[model samples]
Target: MTLASLDRISPRKGRLSHTTVFWMVFAVIMALLVIAPFVLPVFWLKFLTEILIWGLLAMSSDLLLGYTGLISFGHSVFFGLGMYGAAGALLHSHPANLWLAILCGLAGAGGAALFVAYFSTRLRDVYFAITTLIFAQIFYVIIFTWTSVTGGENGLIFSRPHFAIPFLVDFKFDRYTMHWFVLALVAGSYVLLRRITRSPFGMVLQSIRENEARTRAIGYPVDRYKIVAVMLSGLFAGLAGVLYAVQNEFAAPDFVFFITSGDTIIFNVMGGIGTLVGPIVGAGFFQLLRELLSRLFGDQFPYLIPVGMVFIVMIIFLPQGLMGWARRWLNQ
Candidate 1:
C-alpha cells in the first residue's frame, strides 16, 4: 500500500481502537455498579443511588445542551412536576400502585415539556434560557403556595410502593433492591440516549447546533426539531425526578428550583458535553467532592466555596471536561 493510503487507514484504526476501549470501560463500570449494592454499606449505597439519580438528570440536560446546543435552565421544573405527580398519585390512590405513580410522573413531565417547548423553542440564545427559568419559577410558586395539595414547603411524603408486574414479579423494595432498580433504569436511559445521539435525528440536532440557519435552509423544520428536543430532554429529566421521589419517599419544592438546573449544567461542563457518559461521571464526581469537602470543613464552613473553586479551576484548565481529557488520553 502507498504511504498516503496507510496514513488514511491509520486514523480509522485509531478510532476503532478508541471505540473498543470505551465500550470495555463502560462494561466494567456497569459490572461494578451491579455489584455495589450488595457490597457497599447502607449509607454509601444510598449515596450511590442519589448519584445515579442526579446523573440521570445531568444526562437529560446533556441531551439539550451538549447535543442540541440548547441551554435549558428549567429542567428542574419538569423534575419537580414529576415528583409531585408521583406524590399525588401515591398519596391519593387507594393502593399506591407503583405503575400508576410512574405513569403519572411521565405524563406530567411530558405534558409540561410539550407546553414549555411550544413557547420557549421559538426563542434563541439567552432568551430561550430566560423563558425556561421563568416557567420554572412560576411552577415553583404554585407548588409552594398550594398547601391544600402539595403540602407547601413541607412537601409530600408517602409510603414506598411495592415493585410489581402483572402476574410476574412482585416484591417490596429495600435499599438494595431500590439501588439495583435505579441502576437498571439509569443504564437503560444511557443506552437509549446513546442510540438517539447516533441516529439521523441526532445528526440533524447537531447540524442545528452548528448552524441553525444552514439547517433550516436545508429544508428541516428547525423550530419543530428544537421543540421535540426540549420535550425529550424534559421527559428524561422528569424520569430522574420520579426515581428520586421513589427512592426518598418524598417530593419537595426545593428540588424544583432553578438551582438544580444550574447544578445540572455544571455537571455537563465538568463531564464533557457531547459524550453521553460524561454527565453521569460529572454528577458522581461533583457529589463525591461535595461530600468530601463537607466532611472536612463541616456544614457551617460552606463547602460550596471550595467546590466552586474547583469548578472554576476545571473550567479554566479542563474546559473540555473529564471525559474529553480521557478521550484524548485513549487516543494517545
Candidate 2:
C-alpha cells in the first residue's frame, strides 16, 4: 500500500491509548539502568554503553526515516563528523574539556546537516538517498586523507576528558561514570525526541512524509520542514557520535563510512521503523547478539551469520519489530 493509504488508517480511539503505559515501561528501564552499574560486570557495562550510543544513532536516523519518511543513506556523516569534531577539541585543548568538545562536535554536525539538507532535500526517495550517500563517502575520503586533523586512517585517540565543572560535580570519564552518563543521556534524548515527534511541527513532518504533494498543496513549505527534520536528526546523531568517541576513546574514518549508515538502517528496520523506542531496543538486541555469537562460535564461525539469522527471524516473525508488535498487542 502507498504511504498515503497507510497514513489514513487511524487506531481505534480509547483511554487505553494513553501514554501512561509507555511511561511505566520507561520508568522500569530507567530503574534497571540505575541498578546496572552495581549488577553488571565492568566489561559488560562498557558494551551496554556502546549499545546506548548506537541506539541514539538509530533513534536519530528514525527521526528522518521513520517520522519524516526521508531515508538518508549517508546519515553517518553527522555521526563521524561529530566524533572527529569532538575528538579534535579534546586533543587540542590543554586542560581537557568535555563540554567544549561536545559542543564543538554538535555544532559541526548540525552545520553540516543544514548544508547537506539544503541541497539534498530537493530530491526524493532513491535520488535523495544516493545524494546523501555520495556526500557521506566524500566525507569519509576527506577524513581518511586529513592525517593532521583526523589522524588519517589511524584515527585520533585521546583519553576521555574530565567534566570541567569544578564547583559542583567532579565527573570523570571512567567506565563506571561513563556508563551512567550514557544511560542518563539516552533517557534525556528519548524524552526530547518523543516531545518533538508529538509536537504540531512533527505532525506536519509526518504529513509531508506520508504525502509531500498533498502536504504542499495544503500550504506547508515541504522542503523547509524536511530540512528542519533532517537537522534535528543530525543533532542527535552528532550527540551519539560524541558519546561514542568518549566511550571508545578514539575516532576513525570508519565512523563516517557507508557501513555505519547501513548498520543504522538495519537497526531501524529491525527495531520497527516509526517507533522511536524500537530503534534503541533493536540496537541493544543486535549488539548483544553479536557479542554472544562471537564468543560462542569463536573466530571460526562468523558472528554475522547468527546476527543475520536473528534479523531474518525478526523480519519473518515480527515484521513490524518488537516494540511495534508489543504496542499492537497491548492496544488490542
Candidate 3:
C-alpha cells in the first residue's frame, strides 16, 4: 500500500477511541484510589504512593520516547531537579510556601528541559539518548557535589508542609493526607495528558514520531514541536519529583542518578509504551514484584533475576509490553 493510501486508512481526526466504557473504567479506578488509603496497610499505602510518583516519571518519559520518537536516557534529571527545587524552597527559602515550592520545581525542570532539548533535538536515535544521559550525569554530579544546599552525601531532610489552599480544602502532608494528595495529582495528571494526547497537537506529535522528515516536509516545525513535548514531559516529571520529595520528607542526590532514569525506562517499557495508563500499572506491578521478591529471597538482588526474566519474557512473547498486549487482545 502507498503512504497516501495508508494515511487515508488511518484517520487522525477524532476523539481518542469513542469508547465510553473505557473512560468509565478509569473513573471507577479513580474512585477506588480515593478510598484505597483507608483500607490499605501503612506499608502498602506508602508503596503505592511511590508507584504513583514513579508512574508519573514513566509517563513523562513515554511522552518523549513513545509519542515524540525521542529516546532520552537521562530524563530523571528533571525529577531530581524537582526534588531539590521543592526542598530548597521549603528548607532554605520559604518554609510555608507549598505552592511556590511546587512551582519552583516545575519551572526549574521545565527550564532545564528547554536547555537540554535545544542541543539534544539536533541528534537522533542512539546519539540523542547518549547526549541526554551525559547531561543527566552532569546534573547528578552537580547535585552530589553541591554540599552547601544539598548536604551532598547526607541528603536534605525537611518537614512536610501544612499549606492552606484558599477556597479549597486545606490539609497537612501527613502520611494519610499525603497519600490522597499524590493520588489526586496522579489522576489529574493522567487525565490532562489523556486529553492532550487526543488533541490535534498530540496527533501532530504522533505524526512526527511516525515520520519526522515527512512531517517537516509537510510544513510542520518538527524541532519546535519536539521541544514543547520535552518541556511538558519535564514539567510532569518535576511534579512527580515534588510528590516524591514530600512522600519521603527528604531530597537525595540519588533521585537524579542514572539508575533512577533507567528505572523509569523499565517502568515505561514493561507497562507498554505509548499508553499512559500502562506506565502506572507497570510501576505498581514492578513495586509489588520487588516487594514480593525481597520477601522471598530476603534481599533486593534476587529481584533482579525476576525482573530480567520478566523483561526477557515480554520481549519474546509481548514486545509491546502489558498494555500493548492487552490492547491487541481486546481488539482481537
Candidate 4:
C-alpha cells in the first residue's frame, strides 16, 4: 500500500469505543493481575513477568518494522545491552534502586544505538537487516570477549538492584514483588506506547513504512526520522532487557544471541505486529505453549509446538495476527 493510502486507511478502523465494554475488559485484566498472586502458584507470576518483558521487546520491533518498514535482525543487542547494564549497575553500584538500574540500562542501550545508527542508517531494506545482524554479533563478541568486565561467558548474577543505605544495608527483593512491579511497569509502557502510536510521529513512521521514497521526496528527512525511530525502539528494548535480567536474576551472552532477535520477530508476528495488544497476547500464548510442551515431551517438543501453532495461525488467518481476529470480532 502507498503511504498516503496507509495514512488515510482509517486509523480508527478497529477502535471500538463502547465505554462500558472497554472499562470492563480493562477492569478484568487488572483484577486478574491483583488476585493472581494469591490465587495462582508462585512461579506463574515469574512466567507472567517474562511475558511482559518479551511483549515490550516485541512492541519495540513492531515500531521499527511495522511502522517504519525497517526489519531489523539485531534487536538482541539492545535487549542484551539493557540486561548487562542493569546487572552491572546492581552489582557495581553502592546505592541501587530498581528505578536507577532501569534508567542506566536504557542509557546504555541508547548509547549503543547511537553508535549502531551511524552506520546502519546508510543502508535500506535487506541491507538494513544485514547491518543490524552484524551489530548484534559485535555486541555478542563484546560480552564474550570482555569476560573480566561482563563476566565473559558466565555473565553476572545478583539478587537485586544494589542499594547500600545508611541504616538498612541488607534488604533483598522478593520474587513476587519484583514480578508485580515489573507488571505495573509493563502496563504503563503499554499505555504510553499506545498513545505514541496514535500521535503524529506514529503516523509519520507508518507513512514511511508504506512508502519511504515518497515521504522523502515530500521533504521529510527520512533518514533522520528512521534514526529517531530506531533510538526509541532501542530505549524500550533496553527496558525489557533490564526487566528480563532482574526477573531471572541472571544476565549472560545469550541475551544478545541471534535467536533472541529471531524470537522477538516471532512474537511480533505471532501477536499481530501493528496491533497494540498483539504482543502481550502473543507472548502469553507462546509461553503457555512452551510450558505445556516441555512438560509433555521434556525438551524435544520445544520449537515444534510454537512453530506448529504458527503454521495453524498463518494457514487460516493469512495476514491477520491473533489481535486482528479479536478486533474483527469486537467490531462485529
Whose lDDT is greatest here?
A: 1
Better of 2 and 3 by TM-score: 2
RMSD after Cα superposition, model 4:
3.5
**Residue 270 shift from truth in candidate 2, angstroms:** 0.9
How well is each residue in 1-332 modelled by candidate 2, as lDDT tens digits? 33322422344443254456667878998898878878998888888888899999999999998888888876789999889889989998978689888998999899889988998999999988999999899989999998987889999999989866868887676777888888888889999998898788988988988899999999999999989988999999999999999888899898899889999998998888887888988898888888788788786778787788888888999888887787667646
Write the candidate numbers in order of decreasing lDDT.
Answer: 1, 2, 3, 4
Task: List CA RMSD, all candidates.
Answer: 3.8, 2.8, 3.1, 3.5
Give the Cα error of residue 326 in candidate 1, in Å: 1.1
TM-scores for all candidates: the values are 0.94, 0.93, 0.93, 0.88
lDDT of 1 by residue, 183-280 (tens): 99999999999888878898899888889999999999999999999988888998998999999999999999899999999999999888878899
Of candidates 3 and 1, the better by lDDT: 1
Q: On residues 1-332, what C-alpha lDDT tens digit does candidate 3 reach at each position?
A: 23322322365643255346668888898888878889999988898789999999999888888778888876789998899898888886544577877988898898889888888887888898899999999988988998987899778899887766878867776767888889888889998987788688998988998898999999999889988998999999999999898778899998899888888888888898888888887788788888888887887466788878987887789777788787767656
Better of 1 and 2 by lDDT: 1
**Candidate 2: regions farther than 4 A off:** 1-17
Q: In angstroms, give how far residue 217 of model 3 lies from its true place.
A: 0.4
Model 3 residue 111 lDDT score? 85
Per candidate, the number of residue pairs that clash is 0, 0, 0, 3
Which is the better candidate, 3 or 4, if ranked by lDDT? 3
Q: What is the C-alpha lDDT of each candidate?
A: 0.89, 0.86, 0.83, 0.79
